[model samples]
Target: MAKIVKPLSDQQLLRYSRHIMLPNMDIDGQEKLWNSKVLIIGVGGLGCAVAQYLACSGIGKLTLVDDDKVDKTNLQRQVLHTENNVGLNKCDSAKQSLQQLNSEITIDTHTIRLTGEVLLQTIQEHDVVVDCSDNLTTRNELNLLCFKTKTPLVSGAAIRMEGQVATFTMDKDQPCYQCISSMFGEQELTCSESGILSPVVGVIGSLQATETIKLLVQIGEVLSSRLLMFDAVTMSFNEFKLNQNLTCSVCSK
Candidate 1:
């Protein structure tokens, strides 16, 4: 966590001039993000948006985890992969594109499905973890590992015309993802199962990126302890406060 943050290069100043101009994100904040490492799980729609923006925003190192490959069907929503890279692994495809987006940053790819052994150490290595995976099991597992490590987690999901974004600070006083999942119960919504609009994931993913930047740079009000829901059909956005469950299996004990 005490990694040295070097001074911005002339090209960095030129590339991220807009971010450097912002109040809290001056050279110091930009340098912080430029030196930070972020672990992103999944390379689907939500992952595409989150990774792309963070790349463009100049997050120093982005480690992407996904066992899946690029599918022809994913072309509609997964913006990072190209038709030419259809048969390629998603993490490999994302690394290629994201590196092109920002040559100054480093992009790492892991082409394996995460397990308990891999997830725990990975969460401990990164400053923040973004849960963009599609399954309930993975989300639940990532939440628990993140809580154990006390690393911040930003989660997003989009199916059909609706999406939601939430952040877990991994603070004892704040709610863990398990608390929310307990209330809502598990109901996996895969794009293949129910279908999804192209831009719906974009909206949600961009918000996730926004929250991540705030967390990384230590600026702006983040979505911590709050849930943000979006309805593309009605174009309405709603916010809900989240409370810790004292009986939560992961966080309570």
Candidate 2:
């Protein structure tokens, strides 16, 4: 456990007074959040909500990576960017919004597309990684890198009024994203094809934020080896057990 060097300033304490009141999230947990770092890949619908929550929660540092620019179509679900930011790089827009939400957080924006090398380096820098990208290829790549670096990954996806969230790590000997991908098979639909409800992303993204906080504070059981499925229309959630694949090329190999 890390110790606080100095008492929080009155204003700082006042700002986080509510968080300080949580039983498990006392001054120490708040300090842990302030000292921890996280990286979010893809600033799309889910990423928008995840960034807003994490940034406002007083995370010390946040690295946002995205290659695309804000577009009119993105306004439907991507809440972080607005009409005025339509042409701006998504990462840049996210940085600006995150800074305004919590100036205390150090926000780093990368406008370039994420390759394996960049993803590996960014994961190494942060204590936790959140996958909000829409594609499976990126998610699989991220999972491999996370496993290789021993970093914990929070993965979330939302489509057509439903969503899912899971945490993957090699640390607990739990099934990784690679295992899930292999079990489910690679065929998946993008939000573009199936369409996603606005609040569906919000629900899953908030869960991602929750898991990220837990990982940062090293408290509570992460969703390792469990697939949490959410249904917005029915407002119900179900979790299925996940199994590690001994033959998984990315994790087992």
Candidate 3:
């Protein structure tokens, strides 16, 4: 007496054939990705790439959050929003674009600033929370909430010619994002202030997507307790270990 394993449909098998053929991915990994739900905050540049890749990869569901409307200036880096999508809410614009990419996946958009109980419940609902957010306040808030819900977090940020990505498994023994931000003294900066290269975000956001897929499929070594930095100026990458801050408020006693 053996358990039954439902096979992927012809359409799914065809759609995800590339993934199913991978040595590590195969059918089981593709199935796990199909069953995973990922929450992405900030449907801007990073969000655009993250959601697009996740959707096309066959993730079961994706929830996007963003209160801001698309501005003409966003076209430079936020590649998802076209001239026609200008003035549309980012979440709406992103959903429309992502829907065009993959119809099998469910895409939910929250066209409002995510905060309070709503934020808590949203994170709790998803398996992974991706922070493509620009501001430090939101990132810190997400880190704390993700910790509370014991959900894994994949965080990314791009400003000027530099970008960074990190992950927190929300394990009690692991170092959370606040552990690293506190080390930087929480300096707040936006793309408008510092300016970002058009492709720089794509590079980082693609990495974020890569990290998310690895998290979902439980493949390879995750970036937990580590930060990856990329400098477009030098065209090089660097990595650093993030240790829990002993005196810090979050992820520490």
Best by lDDT: 1
Model 3 spans > 4 angstroms off = 1-7
Task: State the RMSD for candidate 3.
Answer: 2.5
lDDT of 2 by residue, 1-253 (tens): 6644444567877899899999888888888888888999999998999999999888888999899999888899899998899999999988888888998778998888787786788889889999999888888899989999999999999889999999986675578898877766567887778888888888899999999999888788889889999998899999999888888887776
lDDT of 3 at 75: 97
Shift in Å, residue 113, candidate 1: 0.7
Please give the distance, in angstroms, between residue 149's alpha carbon in candidate 3 and its true position after superposition: 0.8
Q: In order, how many clashes per candidate?
A: 0, 0, 0
TM-score of each: 0.97, 0.94, 0.95
In order, what is each prediction's RMSD in angstroms? 1.2, 2.1, 2.5
- Candidate 1: deviation at residue 19, Å? 0.4
Best by TM-score: 1
Work out how many backbone clashes candidate 2 has: 0
lDDT of each: 0.92, 0.88, 0.90
Arrange candidates, best lDDT first: 1, 3, 2
lDDT string for model 3 (130-243, tens) is 999988889899999998999999999998999999989988778998888775655677788888898989998999999999998999999998999999999999999888
